[model samples]
Every structure is written in structure tokens, then in C-alpha cells.
Target: MMIRFSKMQGAGNDFVVIDAIGQAIDVEQVDWRQVADRHFGVGADQVLVVQRPQDPGNDFRYRIFNADGAEVEQCGNGARCFVRFVHEQGLSAKRKIAVETLAGLIEPELLDDGMVMVNMGRPDFHTRDLGFVDWQQARARGQADIDDGIERIQLASPAPEYLPSLELDLMSMGNPHAVLFLDAPPNDDLVEHLGPFICTHPIFPKQVNVGFAYLASPNQLQLRVFERGAGETLACGTGACAAAVLALARNKAREGLQVQARGGNLWVEWAGGQSPVMMTGPAHTVFEGLIVLPTR
Candidate 1:
């Protein structure tokens, strides 16, 4: 079967967006791995499936599939692209729309500059809130550490990296992320090397969105991320949020700042809002095409 799909992006994080609202397609049959496979399928950081909203009050139901074919809770960049896709397709005429994700309802606003700003809702900081714990400490003591630090609170678990522990900042901007700041942002090669290590590190329970960041300004940042389910991508929306929150906590950045992702630059500034932060960026529609998936 030829599944109609659209390619879209926000910053540089690209996606294979499927609008499954009007028709019924067996999602179970889709070999999503091949779709996200860079060598064989439609290469992308994440695959987004857009469905009609389950709640009449919402605009759409947003489903996310990582390159590994695992369905995740949320994706900020993907959500922006998803909204743009629907709007350009005439799915909704409303500028402000709500999308239901595994993480919950996320409000997206269509801006005049052709960018979409998302009210990623309130951020979740506790580690256990999203099912994660300290893995390195567990390995250290052969007993494991139960509490791993995320954004604000630490959840109990086993394992913390290093001698006694490693500080992991966990934040949920609709999606779960584990962030660790370095003296300076690691180089690309280092990011490629240690990124997978920390990503799969025994300390992270559900794995994590690994980030390497260096503060550029109180309102500016430079970063590279290895996303969970997806590998290194040009950008990550939730990843940006995680970094922004961490920057704020460390006083590295003020309430607002710009986070430079591998994909492009995202304007994020948060002082205090219904949502603590606001991510503003452009969502673009690339050329549409039919991609044949490999059976093997």
C-alpha cells in the first residue's frame, strides 16, 4: 500500500508526517524502522502521525514514532511541523490549535512570521515522573543509586555514573530528556562517541535525550543532542526546552534565550507564563514524495 506522507521540519529537525485522520491505516503494519532508516527509508529524526482529536475540544491527536520505531510521548519540533502540515493541507483553519500527545494536550500557535510557537505546557522535572532513575550509582556500588537528578527533583532508582554520582537534569516538556552540562560543549566527534555511551548509560532508565551544551550568552546557547529513539539530529524541540530550563536553573541563561541546535536556531524565552517557556521557530514543508519501505 502506498501511504501518503509529507515531509516537514522545524529548525533542522525533519519528520515524515502522516495525516491519518480521514482514513484508517493499520499503524501496526507500518515498519516504521525502515521509514526512519537513513540508508533505506525516508530519513528523519522522528515520524509523526496526525489523527483526529479524541477529545472534541482538541485540534488533533499527535502520535510520534522515533527512528527505532518506538512510540514516544512528545516532540516539540515535530509538533511545530505537524501543525504546519495540517494547516497547509487545510485540515484546520484555526490559527491556534491543541494537539493530544502521549504527553498530553500541547497548545501550538501559528505566528505571523510563518513560525509556530508552542506552549509546551508546564515542564515536569522529577525523574520518576517519566520512569527514570540513577543508573551510574547502581553500577558504582554494585548496588545502584535510586535517586537521579533531573530538572528539579530526583526520583529513586539504582545506578549513578562516576565515583559516587553524576548530575542528570531531567525535564519533561511533553517529552522526557536527560541533560548534563560540560565545561564546554563537546566536539562533534566527542558528541558522536560519548553521546551513545551516555544515551545508553546504565544510569538512565528509559534511555535519554543526551545533550552537550555550552553557554553562549544569558540569552543564547549552542548545543547538539542525541535524541532517544532517534539518534543525532539537526534539532530537537523538547531537547531545546530541557537545555533552556537547565540553563535557567544554573543561572547560565535568563528567563529567555536562543538555543542553537544542529538543525537551526530556535528562539526560546521563558520568564513565567501559563507555560514556563515558549519555543518559537519556523516550520517548513519540504517536497512531498512516496517512499517505498524495505521488507527486510
Candidate 2:
């Protein structure tokens, strides 16, 4: 079967967005990995399938699949692209849209400036929320601590003597994340070496996205992320949010922070405790076409 899809990007993260709502798609029969393959098919960091909302209260529902074909809970960049996609496709006329994801409800609004802003729900620092294990032992070893209701932990570096141990703030933004604040920008080699190590760490049962962040100033952050299934990408929306929220909580940065990813820039805002994080960024349409679903 052939499917119509839009090639979209937010910041630098790219996606193959399929309008499942308008097409009869047998999602199970499609080879997601093939569609996301850089060389063999439509290359993308993830595939976004837009469908009609399962709940009456929501305007739409969407699912995210990584390049490796694993379905994930949340995706901030894709959310922006989602809103743009629906509007361009004539699926929705409202400037603000309420969508359902595996993570939960998220609201995305289109601004007059042509940028999209997403309400990424409250950040959760509970270990249980992140499915983090060995909490008791980590705390006993003085590698973990709680300050201002936020959990911070120290992870031994793989190259201890040569590299400094990483102090990470763990949180769940619908998905798990480990943010490491660094004194300077991290090199590609360092991110390549350490990102997977922390992402697949045994402590994170469901795995985690690892963000290496440098606070450029009180309101500017530079970041790189190794995503759980997609490896490294040009940008990661949720990673940006995770980094900004953690920085705000720790007083390392103030609200309305600008996060610079390799691909582009995203603006994040938070009102301290229990408030939803707002992420603003641009979503672009690269192209659109039809591709046949692989039977095997």
C-alpha cells in the first residue's frame, strides 16, 4: 500500500509525518525502520503518525516511532510539526490544538510569527517516574541527593581518571532524561562516547535520553542529546525542555532560556514549580510524496 506523508522538521530534528487520519493505514504492516533509513528510504530521526483522537476531548492523537522502529512516549519537536501539519492539511482550523500522545495531553499553538509553541506539561523528578533503579544504594553511597524536591545523582565516568564524573539531574518529560551540566561545550567524541553509556545504563530500566549541556549564560544553554533509540540527532525538543527545566530548578538559569542545539534554536519558559514548560520553535516542511509500504 502507498502512503502519503509530509517531510517535516522542527529545529533540526526531522520526521516522516503520515496523515493516518486521512488514509487507511495498516500500521503493523509498515516497516518503520525502512521508512526511517537514511540510505534506503525516507530518512528521518523518527516517524510521526497522526490519527483521530481516541478521546472525545482531544482534537487529535499522534504516535512517535524512532529510527529503530521503537514507539516512544513523547516528542516535543514533533509536536510542533504536528500542529503545523494538521493546519496545512486542513485537518484543524484552530490556532491552538489539543493533542493526545502516549505521554498524555499536550497543547500546541501557532503564533502570528509562524512559530509553534507547545505546552509540555509539568516536569517530574521522581525516580519512579523515570523508572530509575538503585536509588537506595546510590543515595547511601552519597552519589545522590535531594534538594528543593529535585533529585540529583553522580555517575562514575567510564574513564574516571581522565574524565570527570557526571553530575546528572534526572527527570521525566513524558520520557526519561539525564541532564549533565558541563563547564564547557562537549565535543562530538565525548558525546559519542558517553551518551550511549548513560542512556543504556542499567539504572534506567527503560533507557534514557542523555543531554550534555553548557550554560552559556544565565539565560542561554548549549546542548547535545543522545536519544534513546535514535542515537544522536541535530536537535531534541524534549531534551531541550529537560535541560532548561533542570537548569531553572537548580538556579543555574532563569526563565525564558534559549537552548541552542546543533540544528537550530528553541526558546523555553517555565514558571517554577508544577507549571507546564513552554517550548517555542519553528517547524518547516521539507517536501511531500508517496511511498509504498514494504510487505516484509
Candidate 3:
């Protein structure tokens, strides 16, 4: 079977977006790992499958698969690319549309400025929401603290001599993330070293994305994220939202903060409380192509 796909990117987080709505796609038949492999296939951080919404209230259904072929609940960067893909493919004409994801319904709109803005729903700070299970144990061991409904936990450092431990804020933006504030600028070495440890930490039963963030200013944040299944990419949209919301909740940064990722910049806005986080960023169509898939 042959499948048509678009190579798209949002803030440098690239994806191979397949329009399952336009063609017959037995998702199970495609080797997602091969599709996302850098050498063997159309390289991408993730594969996005666009299907007709199961719920009539939604315009479409967005499915995300990591490089490892694991289907995930949400992806912010991919969400932007998703909107652009549907329009470019003549699938939708509306500037704004409601899409159903495993996490929930998300609304993404194309702006006059050529950027995509997404309503990522309210952030969830409850440990259970992120599939984080070690909170109670950490609290009993005096390694965790809860204030204002946000939980902060201490994680032992990979190198105890240089840094005994690090504090991280755990939250879910439809996906799990651990945000670690850094005093200095984020370097590749630091992110590569500590990111994996936190991503696969035992505390998180389903694993988590790790974000190393530096507050450049009250409204400017520099970040690097090591994704759960894709390792570190050029950017992470949900990571930006997670980090920004955590900063806002802690009063470390104000709303409308600009998050600078390695790939590009994303703007995040939130009114706090139960308000949804709004993320604005660029999404581009790199190219389109057809690939053959094997029949079962």
C-alpha cells in the first residue's frame, strides 16, 4: 500500500503527517518506527495520523506516535503542524477547528500572522494526572513539597559531588512533563546528561518528558526538552506550555511569556487558575511525498 504524507515542522519539531481521513490507513499495518527513522525512512520526531473524528463535535481526530512507535496522548508542536496539514491538504477551510486527541479536545487556530495558536486546556498538577507515582513516598522521605496545589520533588543528581540533587515541578499539559529550573543558560551537555535520567525515572510510572529551563527574564524563558520516547528534539511544544504554566503557578514568570527552544520561539499565555494555556508558534510544510507500506 502507498500512503501520501507531508513532512511538517512546528518550532523545529518535525513530523510525518499522514492524512488517514483522505485515504484508507490501517495504522497497525504501518511500521511507525521505520517511518520516523532518520536513515531508513522519512525522518521525524513523531508520526501524526489525521483521521475523521469519532465524536461529531470535533473536526478531526489527531493521533501521535513517537519515534519508538508508542502512541501518546498529546503533542503541542504537532498540533500546530496538524492544523497546517489539514488546510494544505484541502481537508479543512476553517481557521479554527476542534480536534480530538487521546488526552482530550484541543482547539487550534491559524492566525493572520501565519502562526498557529492552540488552546491546550487547563494544566493538571495532580501527580496522578502525570502518572507520577512516587510523590507519596517522596513526601514521606521529606523529598517532596506541595504548595498551592503544585508538587515539587527532589531528584538525586547523576553526579552527587557536583550537584547533590535537583528540584523539579511535575505537571501534565495533556502529557507528562518534569520542569527543572536552571540558574544559567541551558547547554547541550547538561540537557543530554540529566534529561534521560529524569525522563525514565522510576517515580514516573509511564515515564515523562524532561525540560531544563532558564528564566532569562520574568517573561522570557530558555528551554531544552528531552522527550519521553524521542529523546531531545529541536523543540517541544507541550514542554514549553508545561514549563511556562509551572513558572506562572510559582509566580516566577508572568503570563504571556516567550519560551525560547533550540529550534524556534513559542509564546505562551495563561490567566492562571483553571484557564487554558494558549501556545503560539510557527508550523511549516517541509515537503510532501508518498511511501509504500507492506500489507499484512
Candidate 4:
């Protein structure tokens, strides 16, 4: 069968958007790895499938699959592309669209500036569900004594050359994240080298997305994320939100922060954990095409 999909990108995080509302397609059964292959298939950081909302109040259901074929709970950058794809395809008429995700219900609004803004729910600070383990405390007080929420802890890389211990702030933005503050810009060599180690660190039982962030200004941040399944992408929306929220928690900056990634920039504003993190960024439709399903 030929599957029609739209290639869309939000802040350089690209996805192949498929509308499965009326189709007989079993999204879960599709070969995500092939679909996200850079040379053999339609390369993208993730795949977004649109379906009828399971929740009556929502307009649609959003599902995300990583390039490695794992279905994740949420994707902030893909969420923005989702709204843009649906709106452009006439699937939804409203500028503000409510979507049901594995994490929960989220709202994405199409802004007048041709950018999509997403209500990224609230940051999860008190839950160990995101796989933030305090190895320091675990070693001293035993694993049973460790608790949840953000804490500064020393994390040693598995690499022999990079033996320096790093201090990272662990948090979740509908997904797991490990944030490392840097004194200088996140260059390609440093980020690509240490990102995977931090992602698969023993502390994060479910693995994690590693964000190398620097405070560019009072209201701006420079960030580069080594995504768990997708490696180093040009941008990561949830990463941006997580980094900003971490900065906010430490009183490093106020609300309305700008995060600059390699591919582009994202605007993030948050009032704290009680309020949803708002992320605004550009979503562009690169092209549209049909892909024939490879026989298994």
C-alpha cells in the first residue's frame, strides 16, 4: 500500500507526518526505522501520526515514533509540526488544536506569524518516572533513600579521555532530560562526544536526552541536545523547554527566554512548574509525497 505523508519541520526538528484517521493503517506496526532512514527512506528525527482523538474534548491524537522505532510519550517540536500539518491539510479548522498524547493532553496553536506555539503541559519535577536517579545519594544513603525532583549531582562519563565528572540537573518535559550547564558555547565536538554517554548514563535507567546549555544572556540561552534515539539533531523543542525551566529554577533568568539551537531558535516562557511551558517556533512543510510500504 502507498502511504501518503507530509514532511514537516519545527525549529529544525523534522518529522514525517501521516494522517491515519480514516485509514486501515496500523501505525504501531509500521517500520519506523525504514521511514526515518536518512539514505534509504524519508529521513526525519521522528514520525508523527495523526488519528482521531481518544478523548472527546480533544481535536486529534498525536503519536510520536523516534528514528530508532521507539514510540515515545511526547515530542515538543513534533507537536508544533503536527498542528501545522493538520491545519494545512484541512483536517482541523481551528487555530488552537487540542491533542491527546501518551504523556497527556496538550494544546498547539497556530500563531499569526506562521509559527506554532505549544502548551507543553507542566514540567514534571517530583516524579522519578522520568528516570532521574541520584547516584551520589544512592551510593551514600542507599538506593531506597533517593527521592525525586531536580538536584545537582556528579556524573562521570564512561569515556576514558573525558574523565572529568559533570554536574547535571535532571528533569522531565513530558520526556526525560539531563541538563548540563556550560561556561562556553556548545561546540560540535564537545556535544557529539559526551552527549551519548550522558544519555545512557547509569543514573537514567530509561536513558535520557542530554542538553548542553549556556546562558547567552539574561533572557537567552544557547543549547545543543544529544537526543536519545535521534542522536544530535539541529534542534530539540523539549530540550529547549527543559533547559529554560532549569535556568528558571536556579533563578538564572526570568520568564520569556530565547533558546538558540544550531538549526534555529525557539521562544520559551514559563512561570514555574505550576504553569505549562509555552514554546513558540516555526514549522515548515518541506514537501509531500507517497511512500510504498516495504513488504516484511
The TM-score leader among the candidates is 3
Residues 1-296, model 1: lDDT tens digits: 56678888888898999878765666767788888888988888888998888999888999888999899998999988888888888899988898899888888889998879988877776555456656446455553323333343222323333212335566677666767665665577656766677677656767878877778778778888898888888888888888887787656788768888877888786664344667888899997887554443
Clashes by residue pair, model 4: none
Candidate 2 collision pairs: none
| lDDT over C-alpha atoms for residue 244 of model 4 | 95
TM-score (C-alpha, index-matched) for candidate 2: 0.95
Question: What would the C-alpha RMSD of candidate 1 be, to one decimal place?
Answer: 4.2
Alpha carbon lDDT at 139, candidate 3:
65
**Candidates' C-alpha lDDT:** 0.76, 0.90, 0.90, 0.84
lDDT by residue (tens digit), candidate 4, 1-296: 88899999887899999999855677767888789989989999998999999878789999898998888988999999999889889998999999999989899999997888999999877545445564555457333322234655566565545436577777788888878888888877788779887787666767788999999887999999999889999999999999999998878887899999988999999997599999999999999999975432
RMSD to the hidden true structure, all candidates: 4.2, 1.6, 1.5, 2.6
- C-alpha TM-score for every candidate: 0.87, 0.95, 0.96, 0.93
Candidate 3 residue lDDT tens string, 104-188: 9999999999999999999999875455557666767788887678888788899664456888888889888889898888887
In model 1, which regions exceed 4 Å deviation? 134-166, 272-274, 291-296
Model 1's lDDT to the true fold?
0.76
What order do candidates take by lDDT, descending?
2, 3, 4, 1
